[model samples]
Target: MTTHPAPTVHDVRHEETGEGQPTTGLDAFAVCALSGAYSAVAEARRFTAAILEGWGVCAPVVSDAVLVVSELTGNALRHAAPRGPDAAESRPDLVCAAWLALAHQEAGVLCAVSDSSRAVPALAAPDLMAEEGRGLWIIDRLSESWGWTRPDHTGKTVWAQLPVPRPTR
Candidate 1:
């Protein structure tokens, strides 16, 4: 008997966010496969910060990108997993290895994370007492626009667009 390998997640700019909008395109300047662990979120943030800085992005926007990436990656670490039972199944399909990407556009910077799961992250009312479930909420609050896309026959990519503040004349 043969078993197919679980779907993999790699955000290597399969699409492009033309006109400086990263809502529907990959067009990433940098992309990497991250281990499906919480520690990787910090590395993701650092990677984004470095890439944005190299692109001469404004500090404020870069900061937002770091935070946004953190939240997205953190959510992936906790929720995304390979297909399996919630308890005992090792879910390589859910999030064995997540992909992180950064893109520079006319607007600002786009931070994206792709996981093996096709289920998109949903926003819900925050439970003040709960310790979790606020990742997307924070992303929405900080980002100009955020959404997810399921591409081809693979997984979905969650992305956030942060618009830089224009300088006054």
Candidate 2:
């Protein structure tokens, strides 16, 4: 298998105030680069949980967001290909990649995964007897809203917003 760089999480907020809180009111943003390997799913979950915890999100919201990240990242790894460059490099051992981004919204956290596939995700009708195809269904049940967006020709970002309840002071 082709080796890729290990996933790294980057936080966009630069100014540090009390307890690692950003003084600027800018929305917090974090992203991780994921390889096509199945391990990326779990990696994404851990990364999301850490980021949400650092942001002081409640435990319930953090759990929901982590699950959402797992579903999105797994789907991307299974169904999408890596973006092509100017020259197509076709090799049997080559590894593809995707991206997972988390951003703080007004009342929730936005979890998005970008992959090279343009195929839109569909929420399938419940099939209790079936063993597979429940990712989107779970996401719908757990998140406030979910959808996809294609910023450019390269790929599409499948996203979900999970509502974060504010702590009582």
Candidate 3:
């Protein structure tokens, strides 16, 4: 199996205060690099939960968020490995690298997992006893809204937005 490096995450935000200076806001964002390994799914799940908790997202939503992250990240790793087209120049000869981002929106939390493929995900009718092919189904049912987008940079991103309980970090 080939391994790729995880990218460093960065955040840039603009905020304001009473005197238009700076004040804390409810919005939050976090990102992490993911390798196309099976274990990255678990890491995605844990990362989602941690970010939600840190942002004071309620417990029930946090659980759902974890599941969403796991499913999307798993699917990306499964399908987008051994990078083909739209490979970044800086990271050429890539076996496959991915990224996961979580943003705390005013109405809900948005979780996105992006990989090096433009293929869209569809709901698969897996056998009742089957262990695989249920990721998209779970994401559809749990999230308030979900969709996939092909970014200008490279590959596609599968995203799920979950409505979180109002609270503070």
Report the Cα lDDT for candidate 2: 0.77
lDDT of each: 0.73, 0.77, 0.77
- What's each prediction's TM-score? 0.73, 0.75, 0.74
How are the candidates ranked when ordered by TM-score, highest leading? Answer: 2, 3, 1
In the predicted model 1, the residue pairs found to clash are: 15-26, 20-106, 81-94, 81-95, 82-91, 82-92, 82-93, 82-94
- The RMSD (Cα, Å) of candidate 2 is 9.1
Over 40-151, each residue of candidate 3 has an lDDT whose tens digit, in order, gives 8888888888888988888999999999899888888888765445535656855447899999888898888888776777776767798688888888889988887743
Q: What is the lDDT of residue 2 in candidate 3?
A: 11
lDDT of 2 by residue, 1-169 (tens): 1111212223234678779876644379998989866788889999999999998888999999998899899889877754446213643333347888999866789898887776878777878898778988888888888887733456678888888776679
Question: Among these predicted structures, which one has the highest TM-score?
Answer: 2
- Write model 1 residue lDDT over 1-169, tens digit each, in one string: 1111223345334454567654643334788778865678888888888888887788988888899999988877676644234523654343346888888776667778887666767789899899887778888888878887754456677888788776669
Candidate 3 global CA lDDT score: 0.77
TM-score of model 2 (CA atoms): 0.75
